[model samples]
Target chain A: MYGMISTWRMAYEGVVNQFERLKEGEFAGNVLEASIREIEDFENFISVGYGGLPNEEGKLQLDAAYMNGSTFEIGAVAGMEDIKNPISVARLLSQDRFNIFRVGDGAKKFAESEGFLSENLLTDYSKNKWEERLKKVENEELTPYDGHDTVGTVVLDKDKNIVSGTSSSGLFMKKKGRIGDSPLPGSGFYADSDIGGATATGLGEDLMKGILSYEVVRRMGMGLSPMDAAQTSLKDFEEKLERKYGKVGAMSLVCMNNKGEWGIATNVDFTFVVATNEQEPTIYTSKRTEDGETVIEKAAAEWVEEYLSNVLTRQE
Target chain B: MYGMISTWRMAYEGVVNQFERLKEGEFAGNVLEASIREIEDFENFISVGYGGLPNEEGKLQLDAAYMNGSTFEIGAVAGMEDIKNPISVARLLSQDRFNIFRVGDGAKKFAESEGFLSENLLTDYSKNKWEERLKKVENEELTPYDGHDTVGTVVLDKDKNIVSGTSSSGLFMKKKGRIGDSPLPGSGFYADSDIGGATATGLGEDLMKGILSYEVVRRMGMGLSPMDAAQTSLKDFEEKLERKYGKVGAMSLVCMNNKGEWGIATNVDFTFVVATNEQEPTIYTSKRTEDGETVIEKAAAEWVEEYLSNVLTRQE
Candidate 1:
């Protein structure tokens, strides 16, 4: 279970295809690694990889983190420049216990030592977007494609070892030195073999505040099913933020329990693709209740129960 | 409950004293804001305030976040420069609901608009440290003081409201724009009025990954005592990291419940000062257990059980 880090329904298929490949044993080792690398290589998804949105200065900076639940070891990089596939770099970096994290020029230099290639991540589409954003930026005008929505994925391999990860160009026009939830373990992603795995998208800061993924996996460990965990965590987070910030930022979470139950929750009606078995990937859309009691938005208390019984369970 | 944002045991007095002032009606509103300002203005602490350490480029880049638990409203600034009291800037920023977070040059610009004074945060001591660090950095030398250990504070005010926040100079020579858990919510600090509040110090990255403070408070909401919650969260985090990385980073948590119960937990033997109405700022030194069970670095689980049974019972 994962997200385009956090994109619309239309962007889900590409990754869903990657999931399908994984299901077919197209490759070995960590499929999450392959999945994210493919997404990063896919330039059409500008929020991550080869053509991820650049920082405020128009320099493409990347952030990625990966965790292997079996070992619970993690590796991360932030503000990593020049690396075409940060998830790959993160995977490689995770190999050594000496330094599981790196950033900036140091990360670039390390990638070179490890024989990783470097490239210009900005494509014509991203560059044009940047240029267009520059024009409106000074005037504080906003764009829907703020160069963003992270690309995060979590795969529960056949061994039932749940590995979770997320990589992003980060929010559009973020500060040159800004680091989001992407590379921070537990904040952006978390996986525990005894419990489950979770990956988050949407406002990185809010995700950080909720420590959403870790919280989900922990809740699952404490016995809440994946669906219950996602709904409760999102509802609680929204309430926590609502009292102070009026309206909460848009964010979402995806989860997979050890039992194989899967779920997604968000502050808005959000969509994610699931490739369970030979089925062509189906987009699951979760809508919050009108009373705002459950998960995404101000969800209703009974929404997830209804949604799961009426919608998700049927899909499974 | 509070922390020096991870300061020296002695420095804890200053903030504890400020808490006393608040108790005696020596000031108005949250004293956390004032206490942090005092710490930031103090030149002795290299991790925060006027004499805080600089980035690799030898510029002081600061990060801070403040939250009023009563409202659950949060405000933060990252990579902010030329500000002596970043916590102050964060405090002022928290007033306007328009923006809950900001960063870098944009943060500086916002601080200016808010009439916060600008000053170089570098001191000769910090400059000398950075210079020596530069000499050894090429050799990849390591030091315990990476110029970070946030000065986090959380106050359960007379009204029993929880307000928590943190400020930092960031890790020594961190990537030019690197951000630690200091300015982000949940990781650096967290407070919820009904349950309790928490603040952390030590390895900011590790703290962020665990989001220990919020987790602790949430555990309290789940019915664990303050000490129990802190110990369990820290242990779980350490175990999780140990499985993947062999050893864990240095970090600690301080917490308080609405019942006026307080506690501190760490992976190392740590001490913090506490003062309440009748208490004269007693220093509590929590010793870690050999097998790592208690609150405060390898603490004896039995110790917390006794303390909670004695102190917390009286508080209520």
Candidate 2:
């Protein structure tokens, strides 16, 4: 009943893997930032988060928030810049009892806790080069549009518990002190295992006004499938904004209860990549071509197929 | 059982009121645009579908879409700017059967058919000064954070059937040709009265990825209260994004089912305003702040009090 590498399917892959791993306690209390960091694409994601769209002043500022539904706890930091790995701080908050404020402080604390020689190692030379570039570009001509670019994730356990979180450097380049939905809970990410979960990207304030995630989950509870739920939530939100505030942009999610059901809806045509159990993950792009709702399904379907195939062969 | 203005709520209000009015045959297809145009705070909500954010050249570019779940039909337009009311075109498509395209001449033809006079309103000196000033700025610099706006609605009739819709202009002063969640079905809005209905706002991409509305409806079918369902969806979506994206942002939602049981949930620290038949419409400017979750009881209680007071006075 479920095998489509559409946007929704890719998201389901991520969610299912997280849940499967969680069942084995492989991701205890630290699902917020344990991405496959060694992957180059993951690094690119960090760049998108940190050096992405700027704020009004073109200065780089950052904000992020995370929550683990398994524990019903969350942590966030706002208006920070020049710090690498905001997600790491969120991870620490999810794992450790102490609250870490600034990214610098969080890194120091984490290094000390992990017994690393220098906290700066987290920002190694290449990462520092990005930081240096951030400093130089702080004074660039800033525009209101630059304030964007963020990331987030959601995970559901086998027991049907769901958790979601997000991180972002506010906009592209920006005013010194600007805050978007990144640190905000529902606007950035909202999860309910019994129903589903959601995460957002793009314009924060616009989504916040509608309470995007909450709407998606509520609809799912009524019986819509995960994909339909996501689509409807966004449709309603956009309609209202057009009638009221006008300008807005963003992307995110709503995932169904843990039977590996989920959906991905986007305002703009974009691609969402995915990988599955022991598979070399690939990206899937969803856009409207000549035909309505043109979806490039199974671009990455082979990943899961190959992995499962290998397992079957080994058993044989 | 709710009060607080979120983009999601605004969207719900639009679709709910319009669909109801439309089903009652309040106006011919053309008049639906005027109806949506009359919503309170119309100017600010440029993101959904009306007078949206401008393109790189500083001219407003708009995108919008609509769907009828009952018929499984859809309509959309993209890259439309300087059009006063895009919803009118979308509603036209929803009401009538015709060839539809995502913007360009097709949408223009529809608008012209509906008597939409595009007379370069931006250059008119008598127009609102802020709008004129906004026109002076280049669109590339426009950001999505200009306003807390979004409008959508979903409604169910006595037959237990449902319909939902959304609209948005995208972020203010945005780059040329930037489209948000408004035009994408499911990402923008979703409704299935047989299952349930939901609307969303904030972070268009995020809502799309998670399929927020579909998830909520499914959960409702599982028998969770509307409020719980909404909260659970938000929680789960947020947790997922936090794991990959890091920083999170705000989003809000309003949902209802066949029984008219409505639920509201948000990750924002407040800013979600709600109004229902049982309660007077009220606004929430702050979250509980204790746990960062929305506190609707206070606002809901106040609404109840005001409603009850009015009822008793009338009886006396």
TM-score of chain A of 1: 0.84
- Output the TM-score of candidate 2: 0.45
Query: Model 2, range B200-235, lDDT digits (tens) per residue?
Result: 766554554455766676678689887788789878
Looking at model 2 chain B, which ten-residue stretch has the lowest summed lDDT?
B1-10
Residue lDDT tens for model 1, A89-206: 7877666533456666656777888898877789877787788788887777764333447776767655567778878888777755556777767778888766778888877656
DockQ of structure 2: 0.02
For model 2, the chain A TM-score is: 0.67
RMSD of 2: 16.0
Cα lDDT of all candidates, in order? 0.70, 0.50
* DockQ values, each candidate: 0.17, 0.02
Best by lDDT: 1
